[model samples]
Target: MIKRLVLLAVFVGGILFTSSSQNIVMDKSNVEFRVANLGANTVKGKFTGMTGNVTFDPKNIAKASFDVCIDATSINTRMKKRDTALKGPKYFDIARYPEICFASKTVSRTGMNYKVIGSLSMHGVKKEVEIIFNSSRNTLTGKLKVNRLDYKIGPKSGVFVGKQVDITITCVVE
Candidate 1:
């Protein structure tokens, strides 16, 4: 009887562990960004479509991983004309690159949060970036800075737009 109870307990523990690291829930998540326009005014926007898988275990940071993608065509800035122009060749060029993606290469715990080192592919360019984030039971919040020129998303000249873009990501996983 004692042996059987121990086996059952072990099995239940294994099931719980596996389930926690498999699927990530993104139903309440958001990906947003901010950049300065030609007149030095801040322009804020968000991508409505996002999908991702995360295998995160706070206890086993070494095995954690993340793969996420955002729809480039879903950019919304509350300005019809500006939004249209962003989808054109001078900006996102959604026709040629419909998705912006990121895949983690490594994950390490920082002071109180964590850092994800990964590859960010956008506008036909792939570059390594570090994202710092904090996670709760099933939610993760993070931010990173990206240079628009690095991804070739816009012209090299900063006359019309700032070179640096600030991005924030909030994701929840089941």
Candidate 2:
């Protein structure tokens, strides 16, 4: 009886250990981004077509990983003319770069939050950026803003209508 009980405990413990290391499947529907442009006025928008995978271990950040890709052509600014111009070659150039991507290289724990460093690719240019996110075993979400001029998306203007752009992302994993 003693031996049987010991064996049962060992088997249950093994199951738990293996389950934690298994690849976590994050639901794609839980992911989204909000864009806000704060300049002469506050212009807010949102984007769909968010697709990504996240394999994370709360105990060990080195083992944590995430990859997200956004469809550039799905950008919506609520203005038909501005949206058309945004997809032009001078801006996002959807013909040449149809996707905006992010792949994390490192993650640092900060209490209940985490700082993720990754490469953000847009307009065929990749740049390293750090974003802070609230991470838990069940969910991870964050926000970031990128300027159009930083990636050379649009031409310079004396009186800029919009300059800063904000992005927010949220996700859930099971």
Candidate 3:
């Protein structure tokens, strides 16, 4: 009947839309950062426990959106002492603010890649940041530089830990 045909079309459209957007697979995703440790060496770390929703369709970039949150206490530098300090009051202060989040305001294509302008909230401070990323199949990789001082991650006047932190995100959606 005509009514059944309409219902079938609607159901198929819904399924197609749902298939385009995906939730990040935490076990397969990685968020890593690198920062200069004093005048000695570079400290590399990674955070686990990321949760997010991503809606991306190359043909419909106007409707793309990204929203993600990383667990603040999940910082792991592979060095217990450093990780503990970073979780303390002078740094992330995870006891107070336990999440680092980002919500995109805009997403646009640049050449073969895309850039997302969003508000990155961390260490109890929120700042606007731009992330450049590449998408291939079911994976997305993004990179951005974050100024620790801007987020109050460490002492205001000290440079024991470099201010600029390079963060890379590799996410697989399912």
Candidate 4:
């Protein structure tokens, strides 16, 4: 009886540690985006105040996952007027949808990095996206492309802003 109890405890502990949740280093985490304007110039911006829960284990690749969100109102383009405009109805519409969130559905190994297939929710739209990330040390850096038109991100099309947006997400978790 004593041996069976000890074995059960060991198995439970192993299950718990197999996929443990980690805290995001908020100060060191952020999301960046880039969009081409008029086919000539590129407009770049970043969003801060990101928070997330991450469970990652390199040895257990299939068990790793990420659930994260970035404050949409935190968008900064280095121009005050442009930032405010982007927060309005035609762009991010921060008043209604204040958060851009991603929840992992599946994780798979892809070369030296990993591919995270997930649902990206923003601007009241939810879409499946694949984020390929390279883990180094304690940080996870992921990148993906978002279609602005598909997400209803902007009112203007290629005339003023490009349809595709480049996004990069960085997180350091403990």
Candidate 1 vs candidate 4, TM-score winner: 4
- Winner by TM-score: 4
Writing each residue's lDDT as its tens digit, candidate 2 over 1-174 gives 999999999998865653453333433423243333434466555455667767666666777777877778887778999888879998889999998888999988988788889999999888888888886556678877777677777665524435556667766555
lDDT of each: 0.87, 0.70, 0.88, 0.91
lDDT of 4 by residue, 21-47 (tens): 878998899999999988899999999
Give the least accurate 10-residue stretch of model 3, judged by summed lDDT: 14-23
Each model's TM-score, in the order given? 0.87, 0.74, 0.88, 0.89
TM-score of predicted structure 4: 0.89
Pairs clashing within candidate 2 = none
* TM-score quality measure for candidate 1: 0.87
What order do candidates take by TM-score, descending?
4, 3, 1, 2
Model 2 residue 123 CA deviation in Å: 0.7
Candidate 3 residue runs with Cα over 4 Å from true position: 1-20
Model 2 misses residue 56 by how many Å?
A: 1.6
